[model samples]
Target: MDDKMHELEIRIQKLTQVHATDRVRQLISLLIKDIGEKTDASTIRIPCPLTTTDLARMAGTSRETVSHVLQKYKASGKLMIESKIITITDPAFFMR
Candidate 1:
């Protein structure tokens, strides 16, 4: 019975992890879609350029995580940061 309970706990952990991943993916998709639509012909757009606090709130993530990801993206040149403003540098960057 203890082994069965342990197995169930592991399964529940796996399921919760998957659900969290799925939610993050869905959120990223929504953000990209919204950004795409807001882009101009210049291939750069700033849609809801938010502070780390606000972005974290929108994505239900930690501000530190948001800052880290945004900085990573900016470093990769897939996105850009001007002061606190996040701009999509390559509007077609995510089409793949």
Candidate 2:
């Protein structure tokens, strides 16, 4: 199916990037993209439905790594997590 092919292609791309870049950066980039796709508004702050563990699985990394990176982002005013819902304050942060 077309959807399956798209998923396969994305997986292939992730595999390639996984080796070429830092996992934390890759994970954050993916998170931003996912959030962007899910949100309907132009607002920068949007609640993310995915959890840290889910993000870790998608990024092919450990939950601890995702947690650590998220903490840094929170400290930097890029995002915050409460009740397992993440809110991206600065969507552009992941781009850098």
Q: Pick the candidate with the highest TM-score.
A: 2
Candidate 1 local lDDT, 1-96, one digit each (tens): 999899667644543464433433344444665564455664555455568777667556677776777776678887776766555666555433
Model 2's alpha-carbon lDDT is 0.66
For model 2, the superposed segments whose C-alpha errors exceed 4 Å read: 1-16, 19-25, 35-48
TM per candidate: 0.55, 0.62
lDDT of 2 by residue, 1-96 (tens): 999899879855864576422566665666566555444353243355677778777777788877888888789887767787766667665666
Q: Considering only N, C-alpha and C atoms within 3 Å, which residue pairs clash in candidate 2? A: none
